[model samples]
Target: MPIASEPGPGAAPAGADPVPQFSEWRKGVAGVLAKVRRVEIAELPDEPEHLLDETTYDGLTVAPLYTRRDELPEHPLPGAFPFVRGGDATRDVHRGWYVSAHFAGPDAAEVNREILAALGNGVSAVWLGAGERGVPVADLPAALSGLLFDLAPLALDAGAATAEAAERVYAALDGYDTASRKDIQVCLGAAPLTSRFADAANIGLAETVTLAAGAVARAETVCAITVDGTAFHNAGASDAQELGASIAAGLAYLRALTERLDIAAALGQLTFRFAATDDQFATVAKFRAARRLWARVAHVCGAPDFGGAPQHAVTSAAMMTQRDPWVNLLRTTLAAFGAGVGGADAVTVLPFDSALPAGELGVSKSFADRMARNTQLLLLEESHLGFVQDPAAGSWYVEELTDALAAKAWEFMQEIEAEGGYSAALDSGLLAERVAATRAARDTDVAHRKTSVTGVNEFPNLAEPPLSEQARRADRIARYGATFEALRNRSDTYLAEHGARPKALLVPLGSVAEHNVRVTFIANLLASGGIESVNPGPLTVDTIAAAATEAGAPIAVLCGSDKRYGAEAGAAVEQLRAAGVETVLLAGAAKAVAELEDAQRPDGFLAAKIDAVAALSGLLEKVGA
Candidate 1:
């Protein structure tokens, strides 16, 4: 939502300035919070100030409120030098972004049918998935049959076989009219460094550059070298890291190609692809920052007049979850919106179930592809997101984020350059090391619920049907929630083989009011790891021990208020141990159970602060769940 610059009704006089009014508003908020804490105004929440502060992943602080003071100094207009706002000064408001739909089926005929249907619906571009899994080079003629290449831009990702793939595409275009052939636009996804990073063979950077120079000479619209950051992004690189890697890779390509072609021609032969996630502000800022950074690169290379880097945004595969695949629609929608608002020339939203490794039937696959196309259509047509030039242009938050991201990314790019550029950094394992550190930090956050994935680690649907083994593809990219999903899957396997998940007896050691909160917390926590909690109502130590013995559960967990835990936990542990409970877990912190002697403490603790993945894995192994 756009921030309101005008003062609200009735508070300030007509024609009064907004700056002082905004300052007065801040004071009013403080005054109201003071009144609420003092109980003068019982309707307001106490400590409302806490609601206004937030921290971003990069450690950037976001204020609840922003004023004109937060705005950056004036920059060049859209399509101007630097092109921070956008590539075109007019910003293609009338055309909107291209809705690129990917066709990855192996059968060329099926891919052709899918592409035609996609274009007839809402897709503006055809993205042929390149590789053995996609349309083979020999099948390009069949895939391109009956397509009007001039009308829709064609983009393909062939991985290491990019040169051969590009040739196949060009050969297939022989069917198009000579006049229309010159107008066709194709983004040749040929990034050698990206292939090398993924450990794929047949990466030919020089050959790809050679092909790009030829394609540019033949057709002005064909981009020969696509600097893709999807591999780095899927590997869990931070936003700055992804940008840095992409820019450095692009520069490397520019340096190599310029030896044979002019700087401007070399620059025009490049296209950049970045992953767009559900973090709307960050995605938007990353794309915008990319343009600014590229402009600087071009300027340094004596090609300042070259246009801004054209960007293609693909909705993040890393963010897609296989468990509750429907949630991916929302994720893609937000990503598409961010990409459009951030001035991406095109955006591709992957199907909701794309994260699954199994093959989908034609009917189901078509449905998913249609949904992906419609997401971009809805954003551009109904939402009209692309009608405005740099919709985030004047917002203080976006501007600040853009600048900060650019600075961080620029630093990373410089570091890579200092180490002899992108190829050198990747070869030396510096890029991988950086991405690994970020991934570790991110995984820890997801494990502890600091970052929540709706249907995976948090609020999981325990009743959901099991995914069939045939439908489970082993080749799917790893996601942040993979570890948690593994735990759940193991429990599912155990249940199928043995008829039940291991049960945990929850001993709530106080009255319902005293123990209900912790009981619920512990139950949900255990459920996250597929451990069923058996609650026979709140009970005393003797009753709890009798119930545990009757239930025959190998594990027992105590749940109660800190005061109750301190008073009764030691006795409860002794009773549970006497009843032959193999392991005892406390719902709260160990220090919370003050009355428990060092020898009387439970086997382990399950609290909000602990590493949830480790705790749950340990519990599952102990109970054979």
Candidate 2:
């Protein structure tokens, strides 16, 4: 049950003299920490803990520093029991992990063309959407017409029609020789729990279990079930929650399969799917912990020597933004790197333009698909990311995170078991309740700008042209920047109706140098809500009324330093009000607003760390947007 075993400070050879430089290294680290603490205390004397203390949504406290002094867990080598390092003992340095591309099609010929192109262009696997939102079940043959079964592995995501889709795909493979069929790898993707969680009306659990058993019996090289965690992850489950729910689902499948097959065969029949996010270290740790947790499950099921769980990592759809979607390329690159380094067997990087409707953002589907696949190719060929086994194996931070995350995930699995099981918990709404709480906390952080989402919340570019339609994602996961994107959509509507965007008049009360910083801050905040800022430069009280009138803005914000606010903001607010600026606001803290006479104080303050969504929403309403 030990997670890993490695030499550390305590593992020095018996009677071996301690390294003479050890004391010196400790002293050097202490000296650096002293200086850091002094600076932190000076900045936040009352709460300096904030400088070195951070906690993730999963409730894991991130230490500012980790060292050999930390009690590290003992893990076996890669491909060993518990498999924290990796499932495989070694991998081909040249080939690395599988590069999988996703294809969702309602047309058979079109999907066939894309599949062929993807395979020809370095894709090792194809994840086809086979029914409902994808290719019709009847068209599965045409969609897979020319696909060479032995060359490219196939993964099917058929939602409610998984049984029929799996049947059709199997039927297509009947023409191949038995040896060829054995060489073909397919994932039947029969995820009843994920499907039912995503939609209440999905197929029943007993039926799905029966179908999966039948498929496993019929399959040669097919994984009859996938314990997909993306539904919970997209629904705002934290990393630990996703892992726990997935394992619970996996266990449920194992139990069902054992009724027909042995434990080892059942274990081999299931694969796990997790979402890979831009949080690289967390993503890496999540994947590592998943293997450890699932390995423990197999060990307990009397299959101690079974290989670790096969993981398929898909870049998070929830993290993709509809605005400035080009940034998604960067996001997915980091995520793919995490997935690769964390030892995922296969990774699917959703196209950067995934949040936009096809062909609506001037990006062709073929171009986007090519970019997504090539991202992995470049990482594999150019960056050589997969040249090593268990790349993060020895890092103190990663190992400790992996251990702690596994513990937390195990606790969540226990909670689900206590609530009867994964299915029972989902039916009782326990899973949804927990996910909602986590989502609320995340939304609060985003709203207050504690979490910066580039191009949507921080450093927004209002001048960027709007998409022709509101952003549409097939998955329907709630994006982190959706609130800001909604505001942008409203601005687009206003612009199309009136040929111009709503504007806010910024009244600066001091010299440009004294007010420029606040001016920039206020302007960026306003633009994030799709409103433009019309700054008339540093204005005198006498000029404020005329500037507000000339700008013709219903809302005016005073931008200045605390000194300038005390000296000139009162007069500026009064003048702007006299000029019929319906809503007057200040750019500084609430204390600055209170320092003004009650009669002259602006309506509100736009200080750092304010609830940006609420503030922007109020401003948009006042500006008639």
Candidate 3:
């Protein structure tokens, strides 16, 4: 028989009242409250079901509570054959991950200066962007002039010109130490599949293959292939879709290269990059799950002992908002925490103003770049987040999420493989179709305020100045808050052209006690679209009409409790319509009002359940904004 552990300080004496478990506690509370309020806690405004149950896009259900019983699969130790916990038994041996940041300049000499500055600070690696916005092919020698090869690793993203860039880098490093060339870390970043959606040409496959073969022949440690998920992620692919697509792309490379090289050699020449989002736990699970799934793929490919996957995490650009870019610092901090704890080999935090275009290749402000680099330093030196390996290994929520995500991602990868692999899926439009569907659902949530985008969709700054138009470098990158930004932009245009901002009159019905809640709600909602709400407090029907006319606002929305709306909405609407109000809307849903006369019906409603983006757009047009 198993022994029962003795309870400590909080335990009740031997049989005083039995402590209630979660199930019993739930049932006992349900017995005391009415059926409607049972969904909510006694004093808290939130619904228990909403708080506890979450459904991911892959159809995985996250339980509110987890326990030992929820632990199903057993994970192996770190450095084991599967390498789920990372390939190294000792995680913190290298002092921490490589603090990396991207650099882009018109000329190689200018880039060289930025590189030196970055290294002199906290950055340990250089992520060089190559192409029209970065160093040109002819300037490679001058670009890498002052770099110490052994001290800092180099990862080059040359886009369509990866082959030429590789040759240039090779020539640049000609006089460096030959032994250091063998041991120094470098990634050529040849990504052909990623270029398909990134609007760049595909000149990498043949050249990368040739480079890989040469590297093997010369006994050089160089990553010739890069499987990047940021393109798909920024294009709005769900977590499973991103992982599946990345794995499928990796498999495609493995299949294409194995004809010329061994499986281990091909694996050694590859690296993978993933996006880290502000959702810290989800980001952690995503990285952990990606490693586990890739290991399984490697096992199937007959390279079970090929070591762990090399992950380079970049903070999600889709999560960055143009408004209140300062909030991005906190967002990147959380993402970095996830990346560090998730065991990324290298992590890059994009500057907070990444959404705002500074120039070609998205040049960041000097201060912004400093903040981005220092964020990693703080995580490593101050927070000590890098001291532990697989920090979430024992947590029930993370473990469960990791397992579920891995299973879903594995299934998705198999589906892609059955469809003739990554390239074929992209050509057949299946990949884009899947991503489009998920993007639509995500956009719907954002429009309905189901997904809160702080400083954009939620707590917007009505008076904040708009950012100047930016020349985007790539076509595939998607911004989730761009739609809301467009609405606010329209208001700015209206204000600038007419010298007066668009205004909405909040026609509140009934007493202050009945209308205050929705009055505040309507004001905030209008502010999100850069439209000011003119609230004259709780007013009588006649006075509300006069106020609406005096405000000269084309849009009027009724704000009050359902009971008050059902009682006085008809009279208020008739008066407002008589006062020349062109459009009338209600703050609450029509269904919430128990009874309504024909005159009480609004032209439309502006509730939380409606498509807020579309509704706001319509309202702006109605107000001639």
Top lDDT: which candidate number? 2
Descending-TM-score candidate ranking: 2, 3, 1
lDDT of 2 by residue, 1-625 (tens): 5544556666657555445455565555555655866643234434333356689998998886666545476577778888877888876678788999988879999999989988999898899997785899999999999888887789998877878887898889886555656768888887887777777234556666676667667646788788889988888889999999989888777777788788888888889999999999999999999998998898888897885868999999989998888899999999999999999989999999988777867878889999999999999999998898678876889988888899999999999999998888988999889888888888888888898889998888887887675353234586788888888878887888889998899988778898899999999898889998998788888899999989998889898889878888888888988899999999988787566788899899998889999999988887677
Models 1 onward score TM values of 0.90, 0.92, 0.91
Worst lDDT run of 10 residues, candidate 1, spans 1-10
lDDT of 3 at 321: 82
Query: Could you say which candidate leads in TM-score?
Result: 2
Clash pairs detected, candidate 2 = 3-74, 3-75, 4-74, 4-75, 5-75
Give the count of colliding residue pairs in each prediction: 1, 5, 0
- Kindly list the per-residue Cα lDDT of model 1 for residues 1-625, writing each as its tens digit: 1223544354446655535767567657867776656754345555455556787655566677777656566567778768778887754576688888888878889888888888889888888876674888888878988888888889887776777888788787764676756668888877787778867654587788788778877753788877888888888888899898889988898889988999998999888899999999899999999998999999889888795878999999999886777888999999998888888888999999887744442337667777888888888888888788788987888998898888888999999999999989988999999888988888999889788887877777667666667544454354877777777887787788888887899998889999898888888777778778899998997697799898899999999888888778898998999999999989888788755687679998888877888888888898776
CA-lDDT, candidates in order: 0.81, 0.84, 0.80
Tens-digit lDDT track of model 3 for 1-625: 0123555576557755534365565554444453556544455423343344788778888876676545444467767656666666765544688899999877778889888999999899889988764888678778888888777778988777777888887776776765656767778888888778556665657776887776666544778888899988999998999999999998888888888999898888888899999989888988888888778777888888774768899999999888767888999999998887877889999998887777423445788899999999998988777777777876879888888888888888888888888888888888889888988888988999898888888888887765554522233467777788788888888888888779889988888888898888788788888788888777887698779879888889999888777777888888889888888888888785536666667888877777889888888888787
Residue 479 Cα positional deviation in candidate 3, in Å, after optimal superposition: 1.6
Candidate number that wins on lDDT, 2 or 3: 2
| Model 1 residue pairs with clashes | 357-473
In candidate 2, stretches whose alpha carbon ends up further than 4 angstroms from where it belongs are 3-50, 71-74, 178-181, 200-202, 469-475
Cα error, residue 274 of model 1, in Å, equals 0.3
